[model samples]
Target: MKHLSDNEKDTSRIAAALAEDLQPGNVLLLHGTLGMGKTVFARALIRALTGRPDIDVPSPTFTLVQTYDGLICPIYHYDLYRIEHPEEIFELGWDDALADGITIVEWPDRLGSYKPRLSLDITLSNADNDPNKREILIETNA
Candidate 1:
């Protein structure tokens, strides 16, 4: 699937749609460069899943992982950008999240060989030289 986000609100809308369809054990790999709207999409998604517009979904960049409960299933949002090795995933409760919730990963390249075999990967990039407009491509392995 392909989408164009003309503005931040459009990003939230796309995130809402995806969040609604996500289920336990589902993994979403988000790929984008810095300032390319990955966190914006993720924060909106977490809020939609919890049915709370004010949910404090902070970027897990430094902490590496952040989780939110109280939804149909939990959501584990991970920022593997800081990880120096794939084994760090295990230390972050990777196995538990895989079994019980949705995992949304940022900078998933760090996962190396441990990346999920089946996942929905989303790529966001600046479109038409417009910083606010994002071209998004979605690929799925079902």
Candidate 2:
């Protein structure tokens, strides 16, 4: 699906809509440049899934992975930008997370040949007409 967001609120609403269909064992691959609101959309989706608006959803840039426990099932958010090799994901327990929870990954191209089998891919891009506007595309290969 293609979604256009005029601002953060619109992005969140789209995220919420997507979140409604998410399930454990699902993988979400989010692609976007820095400051393109990838993490913003993630935060909204996480909150919608967990129904806990107070939960803090920080980008897992340096940490590689962050696990959230309050949701229906664990939510594993991973950022592979800093990973130099795809094998690093194995060291970080990628398989374990996939076996147990919903895994959302940023910079997933870093995974190389280790891509997950079933996943929702979301790509975000800036809109030329409005600085705050963004174009998001969501697709699934399941």
Quote the RMSD, in angstroms, for model 2: 1.2
lDDT of 2: 0.88
User: Which residue pairs clash within candidate 1?
Assistant: none
For candidate 2, the 10 contiguous residues with the lowest summed lDDT are 67-76
TM-score on alpha carbons, each prediction:
0.97, 0.94
How many Å off is the CA of 85 in candidate 2? 0.5
Model 2 lDDT at residue 39:
89
Task: Give one digit per residue, the lDDT tens place, for model 1 in 25-125.
Answer: 99999999998988999998899998999988889989999998948888899999899999999999899889988898999999999999999999999
What Cα-based lDDT does every candidate model obtain?
Answer: 0.92, 0.88
| Top model number, lDDT | 1
